[model samples]
Each structure stands twice: as structure tokens, then as C-alpha cells.
Target: MEGIIARRVIPSDNSCLFNAVGYVMDHDKTKAPELRQVIAATVASDPAKYSQAFLGKINEEYCAWILDSEKWGGAIELAILADYYEREIAAYDIQTTRCDLYGQDRKYAERVMLIYDGLHYDALVMSPFEGAPEEFDQTIFAVQKDRTIGAVESLALNFARDQQRKRSFTDTANFTLRCGVCQIGVVGQKEAVEHAQATGHVNFQEYR
Candidate 1:
């Protein structure tokens, strides 16, 4: 399959992109800050290259924010890290169910794997102990462009059905809830229930 054959799970704490790179490079999450530092410097070094238009409301502060261990990273950060490391990076988009390639033009033989589920990022790497694929070793995969494209499309169709099932769960992230007794508002069902149990307030209402 032109998809992730093996994987590592990055912490869901928004720094998954950088952590993924760290795993691929050193198999250490602590190295993630090194990746973040390089990326922040890359963006700060040339504002024109990563213009407001290209970054879309992302400014210098945003670059600094990316260095924060808890902040999320996106494609722009991913590309910068790939270019800095001079490695081709493959991000498997679970929502699209296909892998997207970055940094092919860079001069390095190394490759890294990242997994994105629209809202979050994770890491995927070929299993080191497993037998290598026939065409390539566990570190890399044969670049079958046509097959990858077709596979991505097919996966997208199937991914849509999966999203349908998750639609309600996804919607709840932003749906606010107000406690009737306390009048203190909160978000998500879990928190609401927790607040009710702790405060002994049973009444609740949803907001949007």
C-alpha cells in the first residue's frame, strides 16, 4: 500500500508535528524543541518567504507560538522543518486517507512520516524490526506517484463515510453547555457532567 505501513503515536498535545519529526530523526520526543526552534528561526529569518498571505493571519507572534510545546503545527511548519532537515517528509492525511509529500526538492535521502486527521497530527514510521518492503527499505518507500494518487482518491471516498459517523463527536468540541443551577457556562458534555457532580447542580442546557 502507498500508505503508512507502520507508525508511532505522537502525544495528542498539539505538538505532534514537531514530535513526529523528532521521532523520525532521533526517536526522542525531547528533540522536538530543536525542530521547533529551527522552524521559528526559518520563519523569522524571512517574513517575505512566508508572507501574511501564505501564512494566513500567522505573524511573527505565531512563529513564536509554534515554539511553545503545546501549540499545534500545520503544513507551513511541516514544510519548513522538512526543508531545514533536508529530508523528504510524507504526511498521511487520515481525513483524505492519502499521504502528502513535502521537501522532495531538498538534498537528502532521509524520509519522515506524519499523520494528520484534520484537527490533530500524529507520527507514522515504517517498522524497523519488520521486513522491508520489496521495493524499498523500511526507512523509505518507492515513489509510485500514480498509484499514490489513485489510492488517495479511493481512501478519500471511504474517509467521508467515517467522518459521517464522527460528525456529532466533532461538533461537540465547540458546542457549549450552561449549568442551570450554577449559571457558569462550559464546553463539552464531559466537563458539564463533571461540573454537575462536583457542584451538585443537576440542571444543564446546551448552547449551540
Candidate 2:
């Protein structure tokens, strides 16, 4: 019998992406620091590849930024880690119910699934039964198993749809935020980034 696909929630620290990837790849959640170091080293070693034009920051600045434990990881981090690990990382978005496959063109030997709820990431696992303990979770799938991949992809979409109905994602484009440092009101992610850049205030809380 086929198993049920479910989200394995990772802690909401700034390193949720790293933690999610770590959990799926090694069943270990404490690899964030090591993974951050790996990304920094990779970018630093290949400045020609990870250029400022590509990273939106100078290569050395990006490496230093990524090394910070409080800095969040996104597409750039995902691509680097996927290439380093030599496995495809399929991220299913709850807001859009779309799967974004990293390293898809690499013909990797294996793949892992992660659930993204706008700002946070969680690992996707196959459980032997509904409500099963995470200890019974299966996080890796063979890239060659077409049947398994199809089933998991369908299940991941269904899961994302359910989460969508619950409004489990932040609408970064329209969400409101309040700066914790200056108590300034900010609208959406763009304004929040601008506020941070202008005032060097990175603390923000969502406000309904």
C-alpha cells in the first residue's frame, strides 16, 4: 500500500530552510550552521559563477551575509545546496500550489520534497499511515521511480491546497508589518525591505 504524504514542520528560526533541507537529506535538524558555511564557501570559491549580478550583492558580501545565523535563505541558497548535494529539491508552494524544482535539469539520482508557506519551509515526508510519528517518515524518493514521483506530487498538491484553504501562508505582496525597532508601519515585503535598508532595522512583526 502507498503511504500518506505529510508536512514535517521545522522550527521557525531564521534557518528554517536549512533545517528543512537538513531534515530531509540527513534526518538531522542541527546542520544549519554547517550548511550555511557550505554555501558561504561555495559562493566564495566561485565568484565568477556567484557574481554580484547573480546574487544581488557583491560575492564577498553575499558570503558574509549568508554566514550570519539570523539571515534567511531563499532561491540562491536552495540552488547552491541542491548542486552541492547532487539531488533535486522540489519545493511545493502552499500559496500557489505550484512545485518549483531546483536542479531539475541535472538529472539527479534522487529527489526530496519540501513545503513552502510563503515565508517558511517544512519537509515533506511519506508516512506509513495517517498521523504516524515522524520517526516513521520517509523523506527521500528515487528519481527513476516515475510512479512514486507522480503519486507524491499529486499528494503534495492536495496538501498545499488544504493549507491554502486555511490561509496558512503569508501574502508577502500585501501583508502589513510593523517595525519592532522604530514602530514604523510598513506595507508588504517591498516596504519592509526598504525600511530595513533605510534604518538598518530588521525587526518586523506582522499586523492584521
Q: Please, what are the lDDT tens digits per residue for candidate 2 over residues 25-109?
A: 9998889999999999999999899999999999999989998988999998998889989999999898898888898888888
lDDT of 1 by residue, 88-113 (tens): 78776654455677886654555666
Worst 10 residues of 2 by lDDT: 144-153
Q: Best TM-score goes to which candidate? A: 2
Error of 2 at 180 (Å): 2.0
Instruction: Find the number of clashing residue pairs for candidate 1.
Output: 0
lDDT of 2 at 189: 93
Q: How many residue pairs clash in each candidate?
A: 0, 0
Highest lDDT among the candidates is held by which one? 2
- Give the Å error, residue 73, model 1: 0.3
lDDT of each: 0.64, 0.89
lDDT at position 54, candidate 2? 98
The candidate 1 region of ten consecutive residues with least summed lDDT is 134-143
